[model samples]
Target: MAKPVADTFSPSENAAGYVSDDNPVLGFSHMHDSGTGGLPSLGNFPLFVHPGCPGDDFTRCAYSLTFRTTSRVPGSVTAAPGYFAVNLTNSVRAEMTATQHAVLYRFGFSGDEHVDVLRDLKRPDEVEKGVPYSPLVLVDLVDLMNSRSLGGILVSPETGRVMGEGRYLPSFGSGKYDAFFCADFKGAAIRKTGTFVGNDAAENPKILDGVGSGFHIPGGSAGAWLQFERPTNNSLLARVGVSFISIEQACENAEKEIADWHFERVESDARKQWREKLGVIEVDPTGVSEELQTTFWSGLYRTLLSPQNYTGENPLWNSTEPYFDSFYCIWDSFRAQHPLLTIIDPIAQTDMVRALLDIYRHEGKLPDCRMAFCKGFTQGGSNADVVIVDTFVKKLTAGIDWDTAYEAVVSDAEVEPPNWGLEGRGNLVSWHSLGYIPWDDTDLNGTGPMSRTISRGVEYAYEDFCIATLAEALGHAEDAAKYRRRGGNWRNYWNSDQRDVFQDPNDVTVQTDYTGFMQPRLVNGTFRYHNTRACSPVQEMHRCYYDTHLDTYEGSPWLYSFYVPQDMATLIQLMGGPAAFVDRLRFFHTSGIAYMGNEQGFLPVFQFHYAGRPGLSAYFVREYIPALFNASVNGIPGNDDCAMGAFSAFAMMGFFPVAGQDVYLLSTPFFPEVRIRARTEGKWSVIKVWGFDPEGKKKYIQRAKLNGRMYTKNWITHDFFLKGGTLELWVGEEEGTWGTKEADLPPSWPVEWADGGGVGLDDKF
Candidate 1:
């Protein structure tokens, strides 16, 4: 597993750095997404560390306290989904807590004697250790009950040496796509009292040791320590709050989550939260290698971090102005994370939509990417369209208010400003507005130059179809028909002779060059094809470039073969009928052009399965799963958004809950016995494979049944899983290999208006 990105909590000197088995990079301060996207380390948490003597890596040169030696509790220590904790021999414990805006770490070290004294000192610069530590002294410490807003001191039994102490500060972050929603929390400095000391028995220090009171640590490691207890009532737990609001809001959150418990109870509850979430998907595979299983669970855990708890009765943290709290990876996540949310947790899906709608109402425009104030992710096309379209398609909005969902979808699309730059002009949208964005049109407003005009036409046409689908669902048939007809807008950009999607035939000879050949040069790797400017019909900076001898976007002629979704029958006919379509799909699948990594490729890859090619999806899954198994490290997949990467992992596990429709497509399994435990339900759903004919790679599903009944249906509806149950399958490597005598194909109903134009709830993907 790649090292967990270090924590952003102010990281004082700890050890040679800590590495949690969950994700090694995580144990450090300044790590981004202690459980999600990798963010830069900003040194948010600052604790002082007294250096050990020159020779001491551990002993002679020591930190502020005596190092306790033991394995930090795993289940006892949760990380992410907001909490963390570690058991120090079950006596001395540590934990961290987080709200949408801030984190508070609470530590508990049992007092050795009744007269333990909490010391107040800084990192001694003139150390006897290898290197001098940052010199800083405790300015104040508070006892919660009495001077709830102020600081006080401690007289605790001191058994361990003092490492040091300091406060962490927040600074503006560096993210190009940071479209923020947090209300100016960016500039609102983190107000942690300087050089603060935390001990149990300070004056009026909140005594959390009563009955049911506790503290919950964040799921990520922030670092912790404990000192001996002392007289003077120094055995109380000090609450630390970092606030975007006054220190007051932070205190409220602390008080609410931790009123009666001391350190142990709070930490225990925090760890339990993680165990509950991770227990979502239980695994039981006998043959899959250990590496594969480990990687598998690790990736699944990563998906559980976003669209988290944000709605508080106070509403400050949920506000969009100062970019309240909840954030999402819009650019990268729409393709996967959003879809995953629909399946894994529809309620969460609704809430995310709800928060977004809230933002839209407050900000006047829904964000391209959700953040506090600035757009920190990146801008692209009608992502909101994809999100809602994909959402409604699968009926994931069952629990959400449809009227509101429709309003959000339609309203967001209507208000979306026409895009600029590459995506706007690329083949993802229509060119009827400007024929085709000129490849060099970045300098202009409406028209940007495009590599292939057809792609642009098709993309815009696709979005139009999406909008019309929603409009039709709301009884706007005219709007639906208009979009449906416009969906064919890409024909204008296609050059039949070139057999690919591209700009209209222009007199200006296009320069067919490569972005990899630019200068001494900007080394081209994954994005070399992004140099669309050089493909101008008219040469400006040099020669107008083309993607190949063909007139097309970055896609090959084969890929552009059958991407028109609305008219699949025509698409199948265009490819020469069902059998021919199947053959072409096989060609694409076997060829490397079936790039699952991109947005456009998923449908086609699955189209092969839908086309009824025996074992095609099974074959695809077999190859795709192994690729992902070898691809990502732990949970991090270095994609623009990690969602697709996670999706790939989800698929490889043998079942892809197809988006837009509530069906789960069965694929060949990497593991013989697979158990997928859902997070929303306490039930365990298992898929068993048996009765297979190894010969000819039999993949034909024959006589499929659910439970004990003889059921034959290709599409497994949402209702099929109302009370989650086991789905058993009998497989074969060859066609007609299973008992085809009784096997039934998926039910194919008449295509309704809702399928494309949003006429009814009959949406299918």
Candidate 2:
């Protein structure tokens, strides 16, 4: 059985590094997911050192015994930005730090005897008793994360360089791909080296290739080993670089990034890079606990994990355009993650937009949830369109080919790929024909696999709005009118007859009513009942219903009921005006239906401002920071999903971006002062925020001032942010009616779609 380890709160297998406060020391594995849940990929190689080996040479070394120590090590593992260290139970101290594409590791041994280095490419679950750890270095080419190996090779052992390449499939709808690696042994010389096929050393084999055959178990485990000479300091440092292209490229990456491995220089440079990335927004950490400050930085750190930079790593074709993969999924990111990037790093955002466009040109569609060079199951809609539009609309589309980019968006909106659900808009035909997606197939016994038709209907509506905005920007008025009209199709799912009635438990006299909830309906207009707390007459409607119980994606119908961001005015009116909407918001919060952990309810926190209750928005957002989040390993409630990290970053900075729009909702910041370095006129400009009484109980914003004048509303425009200015907010102990007036509320665009040159298309573009 596999050894017991502490729960590291990591759900994805491709996690970069894994740790738990009290867990036993599992050998540090390379390549890990930040925060995800699925059959993970990329725990590709784990390195460990074993003492008291049976053989002195690689050929006679035992290959098949477990290397993990039986007992757990206490208080051993420590992790920081670009660094991780652990002292194993076996008295081997290992420390690791990373660069952009490579990692440098140092292993220190306590015993004076010669030791063996073990490289296990086996899946975590596949580790078995009596499995050989022989051979200096083993390369298992067959077993990968939900992948079958096509081919692999380990070159003849050289003094300081060890190189290998394997072609295998990645996880979850990903295509087959190649992984090439090159490692540099800094202080060790190769004394022995050998290759193995299915657990036995290959006899007189100069080159090992082809599918596994003639082994005890065909295509079982194949690898190469290199035993190194003992070092003077009882330590060994290795630098490894990996690429999907070629071994030469891997070596180049290491040479360019890590160069000569002065472990401290690489480690310091890695930490410095992280500091520079997080340094975009400077915060005065005074008054907040160190833990809270760490939480903010860690959240920012998690945001950069995926949509990995694959610039020169695209295996299919060579292109100068920036290429990125491991989108993991864009639906989880387009909301806050990409928007946050627009504010902090416009250059990175522009490159990301270009990368998405490049993918469209090469693969014939924008990547939805891409991994391993292939499109996987799409979560909701073509959210990459939303991401591109969000950046494009913010005027961040400079230097990008706008015409070609717009064509890609139109292709996704209009064309249907063969596997519509995974890559392109399969349901667009139904959506275009019917105002909303009419449930023509589902609604039987709820066994429709991959069915989230109602959820998709709402997502499609928002996506249409995104396209409409792009259309308006590009002077395509007719296209804008058509898509803008379709954007409001979210109303079709709003069943006015369905009411969320709240009554006083002790006294039946007091009660409240909230109407116009999202209901599942069929093509024939028959309402489908969900087995939920709210829908079940026998069950007390206290806890929120899971999304799966209703015909929604990742959130319940009640949560989906508030999913309308493009037309919040209509949503407010649909919920029975501002007072009624605020009351319903309170009900959702008090009834445990408001899941603050996910993207579904992310925007609702800002909707309070739309209700002319900016102080309440500030209050709730402020309290939520320290309450729902922390600085520990389990700080995030669920999958970072990139969205949560972005949200947390925004929350710390005292503002939230209205996705796809230039507007930002205001809130009281956790810090006393914040500054953002804005890029303007080919230089960095300063955007400063000063809050009076930031650390005290007087945490409510009484009023805000822009420049030297009093700002009426509770928000700022992206143009103002880019131009740079001073924003000052006065705080007090009690809530003040600063942004409570209806006229002071943020602008809510009308849902009506006006055709025939309403936006002056002839003059704009």
Candidate 3:
């Protein structure tokens, strides 16, 4: 659900605390991605909740959930996803719940009097533009983005009137706001009305409407809230909040997308759906804390939430009605999200891959930014190469012949060239082919394109490493050796004097006096050159690349530094010592310069645990857990692109494949107690904990056991969490004497990484 806690419209929705007289309570809506930079949101409600008092302050209300929601439910109770309900002064213990697609709401009113379960009768329809840009740009933009327009086919099969008001609120960014189709729609009487919130807005109880009944949904973007009235007995009041980008599609949902009925039926269905997806990982966590539970589960929520049903399988995919899905920064996520897909949920990942691959087959390549059925024409690189290779290396795509994946990956890399998504990318084929992409590789006047080639040269090297490692594991020695040489492409870019990673020419010695056009010095700084003390700009552009677009890029530089995980050892040596790496990571965390409040520098913050600084990772988990779990009121700080944001939280809880490889790494705990309801395939197993006292401090896991058996490694394999498992981490406030070294972080050989053994294949030639 895309509900925003900040704008819960209830008392304590976020900072404003309680509801003000100016804005009375309406039924809480669910699901929404914050509309920023003139972009739009997608989500809708499933019910209409009308409290008798139209304009009463929240303080006067009977039931208030306050601010007691955790990461799993970070929003206020009223802000919770699916079914969100609360008590009111009007004699109703209102509650709501959502089943993957449909919602169930039950309201317990003061009297046995028939309450409203009406369909389309509460709020009537109209046709015309809700508002326009320019003068009302800020307000109307939200209206436009959240799919709110005043014009639509309001055909009445039977004559009747509905009541409701509309409004727009400030968007999170500079000039934006969220639009809504909100209204009480309740004049007074209940039971007599049959109001069913569906895609086809029906006015008469028996008659149905279709496409002609749909509206403009200003800005050509979408997101809406439907209030579904759930009838109840005695005092159990329930109403489901359904949020969606297309009210038309939302109406089509229950009948098609997410259907069926029943209370536990929906909840059980959701659980079953989640299990099918989560069961891909067989994680057996030991000594988990309660905070981790919320953080991890919530994190899981983030990953599974995105890249909704977007395009279709035909040529008409882009123009279809349900064409838009998956919004976020692909530049950052493509590095890990796509790779992580292979390890956690191969089935869903398969479908996702097929979707992107289809895009490739049709458009000659995949798009980095596809928003609302349109090409955003955003940043690019030969990411499709990286994605496909990582999948083939991990052997994740089932059903698709491995040869198909291999051919897709290899052929694309050969033809697309480095920085494929960037303009004039084909020019660097030779340089990338030879390993390092030099500054003067091809087109000198093509500053942006050449720079990207080099950057992608570095990224491609990463994929090569994955491929090499995987090949070696599969006994393809010749292939492994060939790719290993290719993986060393980063070496060609290394500058000894600069002690920096630069873009190199096909020949290792060829270099050029390059201009950092992408991140023109804040004043007079160099690109990846200065080692002593960098001007703020270097750090700012690490995660994000500032350019012709605007000022700030997606992520900060602090977070970007540590992403070269393959060279952690070399980076350590270059930085002077492991102690230096520790110091830098600590700086990132303590200074707030790294900003864990967002997702950019996410991986760097936890580098401590990987570097034998268990105490450090532990301290971080404890220190920053609160902010991480509650980073969103909308859909995460920036773009979730689905559950990638959630998985970041999941990884934060001590388990996740590092950089999307099948390597699991564990960290210290932020909370004293954590619990995950374990279900293997379909059978549920009671997961319990004891070492996490809920009173421990900066607890570093001293020991771990899987199924009560002690294990050597701190991380789980990709094969684990997916097949149903449990992890019981022990809690302590200090580092263990058995901390592993950074070099030993990810197994250097596939044989040694097969879950229960080690092989002497370090640096095999």
lDDT per residue for candidate 1 within 485-542, as digits (tens), equals: 6555433333222321223247544432111111000111111123323233212222
Ranking by TM-score: 2, 3, 1
TM-score, every prediction: 0.60, 0.86, 0.61
Put down candidate 3 lDDT per residue, 43-140, tens digits, no spaces: 32222233321122212111211211101111224533333445532233445555444344454444423222111212223111211110000000
Our model 3 lands, by Cα RMSD against the true structure, at: 11.9
Better of 2 and 3 by lDDT: 2
Name the 10 consecutive residues with the lowest summed lDDT in model 3. Answer: 132-141
Ten contiguous residues minimizing lDDT sum, candidate 1:
178-187
List the global CA lDDT of all models: 0.40, 0.65, 0.41
Candidate 1 root-mean-square deviation in Å: 12.5
The sequence of per-residue lDDT tens digits that candidate 2 reaches over residues 1-765 is 001111232333433335454433333444554565455555443443443244443444434223332223456767677777766544456788877777788877654453333333223343223322221434344332424454455545665465766666555554666777776676566655566654466534545665443334333445555666665566777677777778898888878887878889877987897788777778777767888788888778878766677787888877888887777678778888888888777888898889888888988888778776776667677888888888976789677888988899888888877666567665565566555555554322112233566677788888888899999988999999888888877776777666554444554543235666776555555555542224222234323322233366666667677777788877888777898888877666656656666676677777788888877777677656767778766677666767788888888787888787767888877777877777564333233344445454676678778877898788787875577777788878788888788778777655663221111111111
